[model samples]
Target: MSNPLQLEVERLLALGRTPEALAAGEAMASDWARQGQPLRALALCRVLLQLEPAHTRTPQLLADLYARPDAPAKGAPPAAAATLPRVPLFSQLGREPFMALLGALELRTFKAGQNLITEGEPGRSMFALADGQVDVVRLLEGGERRTLASMGEGEFFGEIALVSESPRLASVVATRHTVALELIRTRLERIALRYPAVGETVRTFYRERLLANVLRSNPVFTTLPPEQRQALARCFELRLVDAGTVIIEQGQKGDGLYLLLQGQCTPVLRHPDGKQSAFSSLREGDVFGEISLLLGQPASATVRAETPCHLLRLGRDAFEQNLASQPRVRAALMRLGTERLLHISKLLSGRAALEGDLRV
Candidate 1:
């Protein structure tokens, strides 16, 4: 006898339509459950769950399958021990400290399609996935929602906001019925005070994550070795500039490289005649002041914050002392500085030509 749902799933897989195949598999699993074939349904659900861990329906279906009378007995450890090692966020923590941290966490459940965190909202807690999956999405300029990444069991999010005290960067939505362990900032603070090891562990993880994010987002830093990137990232000092604040003045000697972590800045060129021309705008993840850093000269333009900005500044002394050994980073910075100088020269030449035409 032919099973229509199974055939449909197979057809979708053959056509390389994985999303559709997973959906078809879910339907087939449902059919098997309805027909009182618990073991078969459990097998199909497990396969679908593996394929799309974020699918909200699959986990619940699997749980239901497990609850069936025919399901085999399983010896699972106490919940905390069973789940703690699974979370990558805390996997590096010593077993004793992790167990203590695990004891401090509060488990929460969210239904399918529920938002665990929303972009731009203040967040004071971090979440570690215990079961099911979530989709991390960013709201784009055009009002479109883009899925940044899908997270499954053992993964985590919200730590950046918690550590930096910044608003959430992206929205996290449950793809299915999900379970997560929430570690609130206040509770974590208390834990850190009681156990210094816990605090150190958290800080280490935070620094590593921040470095990885910065290096991953910027193409210029991607070629450098991971250890070098970590070293460079650690040397940065976070500075906040309010709107209308001048971060760098034209003709002032550059002291460091400023990487914009948040908000915007406009670079303005002031001519000898004192006429100021706004030449370029920089936003998050953009870097500036590299030209002066490379040349040991005064800043070429003034950069003013258009909005309140958060920046990671790597001072000259730190760069020379820590990052000087990394040839790839040095070469990349030199190339970047050369390109910017050429661009500025062209712009100046064009303006000169325009002024000459005006006088004629």
Candidate 2:
């Protein structure tokens, strides 16, 4: 059977590695012609000649790549053809505009088990995989490696690093021979200038995904309905709280709920007698300062960032405002609050029983 040379070429183009890609495209054309598959050969030839027109065979290939079957009307969209999953940027732009934008992008590819990103390195572009899978990895305290997750074709990553102008949080290693579409930050900024909505879409997508991840990890919110979960997500803002920062002060009116998205925090309780105790330590997905928000009272305890926490804060006023404007959001918040109350009540009751047993 003949190889899918055209598909392979598409993969390379998606990755923004054009120089070597041009050579691969030529090879595909040669192979196709050797197999007497003129149409396939012509498609690849067009791509090559587009890069280097003076190549002796350029004119003939150009004629063939543009050649049309008898039935189609002029200017009609090419007959429904198989294609890679649309990269997010192109998908957002639609057909004509996407193709227009593509003219300016470079193509690239990666071998299996290659690292696409590394922690602490500057990230100036985002990638969209057109084929193969990549593993998102991180190193642990003991130098042990862990797979945070894996993403496959049509999935996009490296976006947050570009948008936030921060170093990548996790490294991405290709698990299999891969081809990805890359959009440089400069190009993205240019597109954002022309189509601001695209930027908004990206931001909205980022926030929702981040919220969903944090919420999913907490037993408190994961059981809610999809619509409710989404509404709760909207009320939240993700913020990075530096280590040693005071996130909540005891005796101050609490206006927001804080969910740890990453890192840890220490909760401190101070008695009227001047006694102080470290009540608990929290890690990712743990939440604090929520009881005050729920009760509309002053904070009972202070919480300080222990190790540079990433937090998702949902302020009471914002929640109420969103509820007023969007009834569904209010419903979701109410449901979550009710569930949380029940959960805390159970925990408190269990602790009380343990104390009673100790006394006995």
Candidate 3:
């Protein structure tokens, strides 16, 4: 720590201006880290301990600056506590914790046509748009990308990155010059260490937001009332699987209903005679395990993940409690099961015809 800067910060503490003292210390530390001087950064840590260890921002500040060797060089510029306007996304956070989280957010600027988040990339942070506009998009099986929504100021996206280590579910591109605040993954982890409730709130908020969207759009769930859908979303537990992992094996008992929220899967049909065939790929908004659940039979096919997947599973009891009363939902699900069964027949018939042609 530089003597002049250290002395000024100590003076603030002595004058009972504790918040000012922490701010000054944090700024000095940030500057030292930005300068890429490890010794100066380390010295500030000791000074923070001596001055006022109880309320020091040293841990978070140091973690932010030097946690990863490349963090200082590649990280976004730090944002002040009061930098962002009223963001409704953080509205769930209490005043004190929200302020703390706000201070951790970094300022990011993007030009028009810049990619904020890319589909299928590792996501370590989420963003809150402070100004300008962005488009959220998803990739289709046809190798085309579709805009899911256009967001302007006060909207936030990428919350799932904070909770799940899976790849990003979609991409966000700036439509114009944009200013946003980014809350990185590690900082949120540290904050969660200090504020458990804050961590739960964020995790819960992400889950509800993620699953609620699925429930609203899914045809089987659409017949249920909104409140029921929300309640049903809560009943479903999140499950993630890496590429090539078999979600359900052929001829096995189904767990319940699994709604694919992100990524793709392929249903592999294994015949008793040892031939295997993969049916069409299953993408977002596709649901599986329903055939077994609805008919009380073993799964008809093996489902394997084609990519890193995020899924929500409703257990047998929960599925019954939630959808058993809804006749339309059950009927719709039954129809889907019948269609899948027909698809299975068609695949088997195609393979048999190919074998017969080869014999001919």
| Superposed model 2: Cα runs more than 4 Å off | 1-7, 10-106, 120-124, 165-167, 190-195, 240-245, 271-281, 306-310, 317-360
Cα error, residue 190 of model 2, in Å, equals 4.7
What stretches of model 3 exceed 4 Å from their correct place?
1-91, 94-96, 137-146, 165-170, 347-360
Candidate with the greatest lDDT versus the true structure: 3
Steric overlap count per candidate: 2, 9, 0
lDDT, ranked from best to worst:
3, 1, 2
Candidate 2, residue 103: CA error in Å? Answer: 6.8
Better of 1 and 3 by lDDT: 3
Name the runs in model 1 displaced over 4 angstroms: 1-104, 189-204, 346-360
Task: Pick the TM-score winner.
Answer: 3
lDDT of 3 by residue, 1-360 (tens): 124433543465575535566577667766765655433443444445555646445545544443322323235345432332323444455545554665567657687899999988988998876556899999989999999899976667888888776678788999977766678989999988887877877867777887888878888778888888888878888787889998988888998898888888988888778898766678887888888989899999999999888888899999989887789999988988887777677677763322221100
Selected candidate, larger TM-score, 1 vs 3: 3
What local lDDT does model 3 show for residue 236?
A: 83
What lDDT does each candidate get?
Answer: 0.67, 0.60, 0.71
| Ten-residue region with minimum lDDT total, candidate 2 | 351-360
Name the candidate, 1 or 2, with the larger lDDT value: 1
Could you give candidate 2's per-residue lDDT for residues 109-139 as a string of tens digits?
Answer: 6777798888668777777665567999998
